[model samples]
Structures are given as C-alpha cells and as structure tokens.
Target: MKEFRAAVEAGDFEGLGELLAEDVVFRSPVAFKPYEGKPIVAAILRGVGRVFTEFRYVRELADADGGGSALVFETVVDGVSVNGIDLIRTNDAGLVSELTVMVRPLSGANALATAMSAQFDQIVAEASGASS
Candidate 1:
C-alpha cells in the first residue's frame, strides 16, 4: 500500500500502472458496474488526476489480515469539497487486485460524477489506445 500512496501522491500514472495486477478490478463511486483490467483502471485514475484538486490522504487503515487497506482522502471537484475512501486489496504479488472508491455528500458526489462524466470519452480512448 505504500507504493500505491506514493504513486498517487506523486501523480505518477506509470508507476501506478506498475503496481496494479493485470486483471485489477475498479469500482467507482459513481458508476454501477466495475471496470476491469489495469489499462482501463489506470486510464480512469488519470481522469481523476485531471479532475481533482488539492487531493491528499488524511488517514489510512490497514486490515488486520494484511489483505487490504482503506485510505481516506479529501479533494476538491469543481470547487466542491469531497471526502472519499479508497479500499484497496492486493494479491500475493503485492500488486493491487481490486480498488473500490466511495465518496460522500450529495453536492460533492454530483460534482465528481459530472466532472468524471465529461472525461469518459477521453478515458475510454486512452484505455483503448493503451490496450492496442
């Protein structure tokens, strides 16, 4: 999880990609269906990097079983403050296998959704281009 935090804090998408499993699953706070695969998830996170401002992790909770970790963070989207958590589970190889994100407050969530929605096309295109 140290690697994940470091990569995110540094806004290093290539490094982030290196830490994810090939078949990693990503659960978005605003999306109903989870996105799969490293390329796509990396692309989505890239979009997030573009949308969020003043992002920082405030707290981190590690699972007793050494299986997962929850990272609590805060950021601004469209001038709205958003509080969120990233639930990350790793495989035996220490590569992120699943990532679930949750955010709070109606206004912040709506702002996040709206902002991300605007980037969907670019995200999909990047992901597809990477896979190709």
Candidate 2:
C-alpha cells in the first residue's frame, strides 16, 4: 500500500501498472460500466492522475487478513473540491485485482467525468494512431 500511495502521490503513472493484476477491474465514480482488464484499468488510472490535482490521502485502513484496504483521499478537479475513497482488493500474490473509486460531491464527480471522458478519447486516439 505504501508503494501504491507513493506512485499516486508522485504521479508515476507508468509505475502504477506494476501494482495491478493482469485481469484487474476498476469501478469509476461516475461511470456506470466497470472497466475490465489491465490495459483499460491502467489507462483510467493514468487519466485520473492527470485530471486530479492537489491529491492527498487522508486515511487508510487495511483488512486484518491483509487481502483488502480502503483509502480515503481528497483532490480538486476543475476547481471543485472532491473527497473520495478507494477500495482495493488484492490477490494472494498482493496484486491488486479490484479497485473501486467513489467520489463526491456531485459537482466534482461531474467535473471528473468530463475531464476523464476527454482523456479516454485521447487515449483511444493515440492507441489507434499507433496501430496504423
């Protein structure tokens, strides 16, 4: 969890991927569909890293069994202050298999959605161009 926090705090987007499992799943705060697989999940995480500013983790609680943890954080997006929680579940190997993010208030969630949509579009365009 320390490594994960360091990566996020430092905005090490590439390094974040190393913490996820190959079949990782991500549940976004505003998105209805859960993103599946490492590539898409990683892309969303990277997009979030780019979109949010002044991010700070306020609290973290790890399960007694060490299989899961929850981190509460604060950030600003498009000038809207947002409070969020990340619920992370890991496999026996300590690879994150599921990550669910919940953010508030409504204004911040909307701002995040708008920004992330643009980022996702750019990611798609870059991937498409690379394959061409």
Q: Write one digit per residue (lDDT tens) for candidate 2, span 1-132.
A: 677778887889768889999999999899799888777777678778888999999999999988888999999998999999999999878889999999989998999999888787755553344411
Tens digits of per-residue lDDT for model 1, 1-132: 999998898877666888999999999999999999998998898899989999999999999988899999999999999999999999999999999999998899999999999999988998989532
The lDDT of each candidate is 0.93, 0.85
- Model 2's lDDT to the true fold? 0.85
What is the alpha-carbon lDDT for the whole of candidate 1? 0.93
- Residue 2 Cα positional deviation in candidate 1, in Å, after optimal superposition: 0.5
How many steric clashes does model 2 contain? 0
Tell me, by TM-score, which candidate is best: 1
The worst-scoring run of ten residues by lDDT in candidate 2 lies at 123-132
Off by over 4 Å in 2: 125-132
TM-score of each: 0.95, 0.92
